[model samples]
Target: MDMSETSQPTIDEVDLLLANARLRDELEPYRDESIDTSTGRMNLRTENEYLASMLAWERAPALPIASWFTPVLELPPPDSLDDDSLNELLSATIEKLYSQKVVLRFTDHLSNRELYKIIYRDILPCCEKKVEIPGKFLEWRCFEDTDTWLRYYADAVERRRYQEEHDVRMPPSERPKYRRDLPH
Candidate 1:
């Protein structure tokens, strides 16, 4: 009797299931108030992807921030600075940040002083962010409520026109760009 054509045994998914369970179990201890509170549960796969990223970050070696910003940077106080001097400093500082892959946006409306202050204070202080993976960047969101900018920063003509064009009863929900992609 020829047994060469006997059907091959099917591969069991038991290992895969067990592996996923193990990954989840290992990740369970990491779940806390700080485990990506901004991350949304779009679906099982999305949740799993986030968990996997968390695991990878936890496992990856942390690189000194100097690896990103060399020689370090020191900025004088944003106070008592003229527009020309502040602009020069801001340009250099922004370029340094760009070199580190940290981009700042939505700052066109900010004054030279305000922008420099944010860089000198909030931004420079945050330069110590741990680098686990390469190519990841930190985008400093200066504006929490864009609506406030539109309402307060906009000229009277623009605000009136906007009010005329859009519903004034209720403003549209403006979620942060980072949290927008996250599943609610």
Candidate 2:
């Protein structure tokens, strides 16, 4: 009913309008660029670089959990019978890597370890029977210590090199020469 009360409402309205404008400006980059959202895909390399930069920002950490796990889990399983069995066993081992107590405490719920155990003991063995490779010899080398694991990891690098040499054909003695005198 007074002059101050009327002016207060006007000030509040201006404040709300300013806040809404700020929010809209903040969200401008995420707005739809195309009419068909389903067809729109982000550039993976650019996104990855952007994410790396963001993770390297002062307030954040670069914990690439997905990248670390992808190579190990996404590789094709072995073809031999024993290797096939080992693959099944490895799958089960991965599933049960975190114990029940750890899962319950961390996830705040119970998980079915029985399925994992069954896969390890039963399903894996059946899968192994179909493979042509010697299962017992492979199984003997399956369990290893941290040093052994590192050695195996290094061995994989050699395997990769061998695969690249065998599969990729390159012309001999055609290496490019570097010119170092031009740039400052």
Candidate 3:
């Protein structure tokens, strides 16, 4: 009923305008004849979101996993920690890593010390692209051997196929040594 209310842009309209401006700014440095940003093949919102995510990922810094946290995540020597202390610290550390979007997979086969050592010696020191986008996570597989994966996770048919493909006999399947209920 009021001219002021009709003249003013809604919140969603303002947000859309802001998003379009951001999308244009993000597209500026990446301009090329070959880059197809046309909305004919995709929805404008989806395309804009995709381009924004691409720019975010491209601009993300590569840093050590430990440095991702404030003050850095420092762990005590594996030898100095007793079994109870090690287990508690390991669980807390796993939670902390998950909070930073770092997930440890197929770690049940490893003992607490082994997993902790791997996290400390390998994962903490490793440099990874730190993409701080929502729903983005880095899955670190603790096991490298396909045999371990087959034994622990694969079904009978999958295991049989793997054995046939590799031309090697696989050991009988067994359950994981310790399965922790952690966020995926």
Regions of candidate 1 where Cα sits further than 4 Å from its true position: 1-28, 33-49, 56-68, 127-131, 144-147, 152-184
Give me candidate 1's TM-score against the actual structure: 0.51
Candidate 3 matches the true fold with a TM-score of 0.75
Predicted structure with the largest TM-score when compared to the true one: 3
- Predicted candidate 1 versus true structure: per-residue lDDT over 85-167, tens digit per residue: 99888777777776776777666546667778887777776535454445566676665574855643456676667778875
Best by lDDT: 3
Write model 2 residue lDDT over 112-140, tens digit each, in one string: 23333333343334312111221111121
Clashes of 3: 0
Tens-digit per-residue lDDT, 140-168, candidate 3: 99987888888787899998898888898
- Which should have the higher TM-score, number 2 or number 3? 3
Tell me the lDDT of candidate 3.
0.86
Candidate 2 at 70: error in angstroms? 20
Q: lDDT, candidate 2, residue 85?
A: 62
Candidates 1 and 2, the one with greater TM-score: 1
Off by over 4 Å in 3: 1-41, 160-168
Clashes in model 3: which pairs?
none
Mark the 10 consecutive residues where model 1 has the least summed lDDT.
Answer: 175-184
Q: Judging by TM-score, tell me the better candidate of 1 and 3.
A: 3
